[model samples]
Target: MLPRGPRAFSQAAATALRPPSGSAPERLCVAELPGSELAYFAEGGGGGDGGRPPRGFLPPPGRCFSFCVPSGPSAGERVRAARLHRRAEQRLSREPFGPGGAAEVLPLLAYAGPSGSRPEKGFLVRDRRRLPETERALEDLVRLILPPPARLLSVYEAAAAEDGGGGPLWRSLWRLQGAPESKVLLGRARVAGAAEPALHPAAPHLLDGAAVFASFEAARASLRECLSVIPEAKAVLDLVDGCPVHAKKGDFPVIVIEGLDATGKTTVTHALKDSLNAVLLRSPPPCVSQWRKVFDDEPTLIRRAFYALTNYIVASEIAEQSTKSPVIVDRFWHSTAAYAIATEISGKIQHLPPVHHPVYRWPGDLLKPDLVLLLTVSPEERIRRLQGRGIEKTREEAELEANNIFRQKVEESYLRMENPACQPVDASPSREEVLKTVHHLIKKQCHFP
Candidate 1:
């Protein structure tokens, strides 16, 4: 349901909330949202008594669409953003993109230009299995997502003056090939040059280098750039280089346990270390832990390289120690790539580089673990654990709660790798029980004595 209130009600908002005029999803999923959030779905004309969204409304794909929520209700706006984002996630999980299938949907948040005019947003329907099926789906999606530019224009006053309002700000759409260069052109607002209204084909300058490292050398250059901003990060970089790469692969197995904060990964890892008589090592090894937080605050490229470099450092440790006994690791490249990929993109999972994409592939230079045990827990349980721990949450931990899409993508990306795929372990069980289960898996897989 859209929000209800005389001020909030509008024909454009209502129309946009529904599946565009002619296209309707095969099925509509209805979930029980809290009564407090009812206002968001209730806003606009014809929500009637129940305040539900109009029938035929398939929850918009995992992208936020403008005109979905009526403007000016700050509290309602926040609540609706959360709900719509969740809805988008729901749709994406249900309909994953396969080979030749399009994975992303774009919901442009159009706003009034200088003089005021409408704009558009869209998505492509695709399937690797059938061309006709793909075409039909794409058409339905395009029609269903008919963005109400007029409604966005109606609410465009506050931001217009600052950005320099004009007419339809842009008219362009980029092909979403599911790659590093992919982009979604949301509605453009007014800008500096009013004499000519040209389309902005590129994504925002801030996102230029999001979640990417063209090569190790590129990563090094970018790392140096970040270090220049924070002198302390340079020290960490030096310390990582201080540890020489191991000359030979270890005789014993190296196992890595990874999961979000409060998922018992730390506890399980230490226990496994003792049980397996294994040496415990962490990425951003103890030598560099001092600056882990420092680099964590820096932008994506630098932060990832810091973690990536730590893996090489730990690889050195693993190679040396596994000669004597097994090596147990707390985190590794999976953490680095997953968080990087998730943070770099917005909206649906489809927007992310698909599974098996090169960006998701493990780095060639870094040593691969004998087995990577990835821990998983439900969102409700993960939150409960975080609250119980009472420690200051890391930025990543905080984001896990703040953005559902980001959190989901991180876990998905972690499990998507193939060079050394992550084996999912349910961490929701008792710590002792989880350890026992993982022990069985480790012993069976590693043939550990």
Candidate 2:
């Protein structure tokens, strides 16, 4: 329910939250509010016998909205909050509605959890006149957004600010209930005469394995189930099925090269292949390259599974090739998990799962590399190289160019992996220097003569 109180909510705060009038098309506007500040605002509006927020304190129509808590009251309760926010934002942006009837998706407001943690929710404010439309949209959005294991409880609808009592009031017309945890939190808050909704805890960070993959085997099984839903999965899976899943590692060392796009991975790996006389391979290996675009468009779960399964196929190839020569992989599990984790967790790098978190661990069953080298270049140099290539960028590569937070998260995720953690290699230097440096590391680390 929208918070209300007799003290009259601050007009200044409302004005500050309002979207600026612009000549451009209607777009989603992100509004940031600390849980503490929101609670203070809600408490200031206190009224009614039940000690619920008092009515008639909201600003005028089109400007009234409330932020709700994620499902689960306790801080320890875990939910796919980041993914849920992302999925909801994606759905809402697709719809033709915003401040006006026609709208575009805008960047989400930064709402940090307690003590500046990952954002708990993404808030969208719609015109009250389109309540019916908003309700229908919410229903459809929820249908697509709630795919099980996601714990979003409800999407509350706020009435147009109504004039009564002392000031305008924002009322909760209704909530499309998806889970009961939200109600429990609200009930407790109301009972305690607290204004703030239950603030989510700071732990769980960005990469919660349970929220995505508990294990490699579990991810593969889930991918199979999603095959019916995402037809692209079959084409990608066919490539996976052709390879031997259980292959013995050959005598030679298997080295993986990891980095963001235009980070000299191709140049370095190719050079290493010639210098070391090693067999070259890559995930989403040459076999599935044709279908890469098809699965890239799929949902996060399906897309990640696609890439992950490819590694196993690559693993089989590595086993075979390593018998004759050293194996140099363009990208492998580190690339897969780094990109997936970075994309899944929104906001700053700090929002990423804590260092040494289980999500950063190497899969116990997957084939392990002898040594992994992560090539990094300054952002400016990376963009310069990207321009120099003139090749089409992968989805993540494109995002890497534009989103610093995302790029940082991917870099950090690469650094955080345990067991076979990646060794950093500065690729900012000349291509020849970079290769020479890598050659030294490989011979030193892999005991190559």
Clashing residue pairs for model 2: 4-45, 4-53, 4-54, 5-45, 5-46, 5-54, 47-54
Give lDDT for model 1: 0.52
Which window of 10 residues has the lowest lDDT sum in candidate 2? 184-193
Model 1 misplacement above 4 A: 1-216, 245-247
Against the hidden reference, what TM-scores do the models get?
0.56, 0.68
Number of the predicted model whose TM-score against the real structure is largest: 2
- Our model 1 lands, by Cα RMSD against the true structure, at 17.0
Model 2 C-alpha lDDT per residue in residues 97-161, reported as the tens digit of each score: 54345422223333332344344444534344434455455555554565533322322222333
* 1-449: candidate 1 lDDT, tens digit per residue: 22232223232233332323343211111111222110112112222234322221222211112223222223232223323333333343444433334443323322233233221121222222323343333333323332333112111111112234321111112222232323343322211111111222111211223334433444454455554357875776686667665335577888999888878888899898889888998875888767877766654445666676677777778878978899899998888778877765444465556566667666766677889998999999888877766676667768789878778878888888777899999998888889999999997889554
